[model samples]
Target: MDVKLPEGLEAFLAAAGWGDAVIEPLAGDASFRRYFRLRLGEQSAMLMDAPPPTEDPAPFLRAAKWLDANGLRAPRILAEDAPRGLVLLEDFGEVRVREYLDQWPADEAEVYRAAIDALVELRRLPPGPFLDYSLAEYQREAKLFVDWYCSARGLDVDAASYSAAWEEVLSPMLPRQRPGVVVLRDYHAENIMLLGSLGDQGLLDFQDALVGHPAYDLVSLLQDARRDVAPELEAQMLDYYLSKTGAGADFTADYARLGAQRNAKIVGIFVRLWKRDGKPRYLDYIPRVWALLERDLAHPALAPVARWFDANVPAGLREAGGGSWQP
Candidate 1:
């Protein structure tokens, strides 16, 4: 069975002046979006198939323009047909930070430092036009654990208490995010492209960008789901970021708090991907995320949420497949 190209994809590519290009299917992420690598002689571009109503390319377009205008290394958009959900984009060749580091483990410090530097640079810019990562949004995301994880594991826990715990833990930290920065919600190694040397990073998968606490993206980078960042490296990167930004003492606590929140969201998301979307491979990352979440929960800032977890989610069930359900 061959993978079918989206309707009108060929015409869209031809209209973008790459009519004779060779198209090759590219690996897609967790979203409904599909990608193709197009080559015509010396010219190459990425074709994004973000068909609606399950997918939309408008947000990607908006973030790409904003990032490029602000001196960030987002891919350049060559052409777009928003309603049809097709776009031609600059091909930022295949060297991703994760794969690169896997091959050259010796350069971890240099590469990670560059990633932190990119975050610092992003912090200096005015946030792009986007919705805030509001308290309601925070609570909504946090509840995914209870919504999907608990239900899947057959646990009849106190849902209201879980919500209350998150409220107690997160409310105080909300004010610290006043006039937040543009947080690329998925700023991890996989989405990062090694443009040239150690420090040159090309960004991707930023359609979910939001105006949120700066620490959020830092957590996303340091506490990645798919990759295991060393504890020492995570510490060095955190300190490096703080030294560069001059963030106050409270920043560490904020980082821990956000890490717990983000990790919890990811656990639920992975479960949802398995149970709802039929993508069970995401289950493999659960143990890693659980470890990160537990570490984050250790901070005093997360005591309330930590207590809730202690009482609700059993230690055995925290692993891949909720200690029962299998792919």
Candidate 2:
């Protein structure tokens, strides 16, 4: 799985005073961005190659700065060549929460407690310098399921009804986001680094942070697509968060609504990754996401979107085309 170094990267690294470092390719996510670990004797840093036109390091840099400024642990920027889309960042080490939890399932609750506490802390802070997660954006994201997932499943759905359903459900919550908090759009176990202690977390992949509902990130965490979180654990964590924040009664409905929206978006995005980006492995997570989406749809707040699903997408077809689905 060797990846070729990007053009001019050597010159860029040399100019940054790391000409003699050893470079090793790192695991990449569902993006055009590539990462490499740079080791200079005892020191280490990560080189993020978010090539232009498709990916940009500007958002990452901004989000990192804000998180660091607010006492959160994001990778420290060692050096940057933003025009070339190259950034040298502090290596948060190899202890990922997702992998660690898999090996030590006993510590799941304790670890998730810390993650939930982090979210509660985030809600206490004011919104960051990002755009609102508006009703239109919510509609656009939910539509990904219709645009990619439906097409891949060979099921022609009522696209207009889908849009209206999302709008109807999401419009009320938009008002709650008046003085919105910073919602780390991807706040799952995989994106978190367990540095030293479970309470001490390192955040990653937060470039898409937005001023949105407080419950959105919570949904992202509890209703994870990559891993199966036990229903008991999910319930415990939700109660823990509610006790910590003293959030209003509407929080439950808001969490469910956002969960359905985010899960729908992920289902579509996974399909798009396979169909458009030639990454079929993402399809394996489709069934897991569908399960989460179905759970969310059970909430009363999601009645409209649930009706759309009932009328258009069949239960058998909803998750029948994950890994073996062909375009």
Candidate 3:
């Protein structure tokens, strides 16, 4: 099998000292970036092919540095060719936690414990070099539910008021008054690489990290939209996080709000990926996400958003437009 190289990417790999390595292209996410696994003898590394105009490697570079400094296992930057949007990175290897779970079902609790521990460790770092996950940003993101998803479904309602409702509810919950910890926006099982039997995890797809509510990443982990985390485990993990962090009583409410917020954004993003970006596989995850969204809305803290749903969206439409519900 042959893999086409992005323009100038081959030259960069050579200059970066991997000219003779075997390059195996890996499946990329819903972005313009591409990754190649380069193996030469016992030495292995990953090469990023993030093209210009559509993508930038700087955020990933900055994030990698910050994560490594904070004792997380982000891939080390072995070499860089920023002008051509290529970076040689230390390969963290395969075996995503989600994949690992397929064979080791009993390790579920311990694996989530490690992930939650990573989040706790991350919260200790001082915020720097990241966008504040302010109310405006949250509103902008949540509005995606109205923009792409609603339009795709042809569901016409008050999108403006929808945003207002979000602002009214979230302004107090995730108030823009202060700074926050760095949030790896897509922290989930797929993005977490299970490095060893010792329960270490490697972070990936963190170029979109931002300063946001500490609960945001936690919800991203436990209430993953792409995969179903057992409700029992989810509850235990939440308790574990709260116990270790000693957060106030508002912690549960915060988790529910951000969970709803993130899932709604993902609903829109999945639709956009299909209708605009021509990727339809994400639609299969909608039912999973909708289930998570419904659970989040059930929280009393989300009554305002729930009322909006009850009034605007019918029960059947709540799960409408979703593909096959996978377990």
Compose the digit string of candidate 3's lDDT tens values, residues 25-144: 988889988888999999999989888989999999999999998798898999998878889998888889988887888888999899898898888878868988888788889989
Q: Clashing pairs in model 3?
A: none
Give residue 64's lDDT in candidate 1 (0 to 100): 94
Over 4 Å off in model 1, which ranges?
Answer: 318-325
State the lDDT of candidate 1 residue by residue for 44-156, as single tens digits.
Answer: 89989999999999999999999999999999999999999998999999999999999999999899888888899888987779999998999999889888888888899
Q: What's the best-to-worst order under lDDT?
A: 2, 1, 3
Q: List, residue by residue over 1-327, the lDDT tens digit for candidate 2.
A: 658998888899899899899999998889989999999999999999998989999999999999999888899998998988999999999999999998999999999999998888889998889999888788889888889988987787899989988989988888887799999899999999998997888999999888999999999999998989999999999999999999998999999999999999999999999999989888889889988888899999999999999998876675553335654
What is candidate 3's TM-score against the reference?
0.95
For TM-score, candidate 2 versus 3, the one ahead is 2
- A best-first ranking of the candidates according to their TM-score comes to 1, 2, 3
Error of 1 at 295 (Å): 0.3
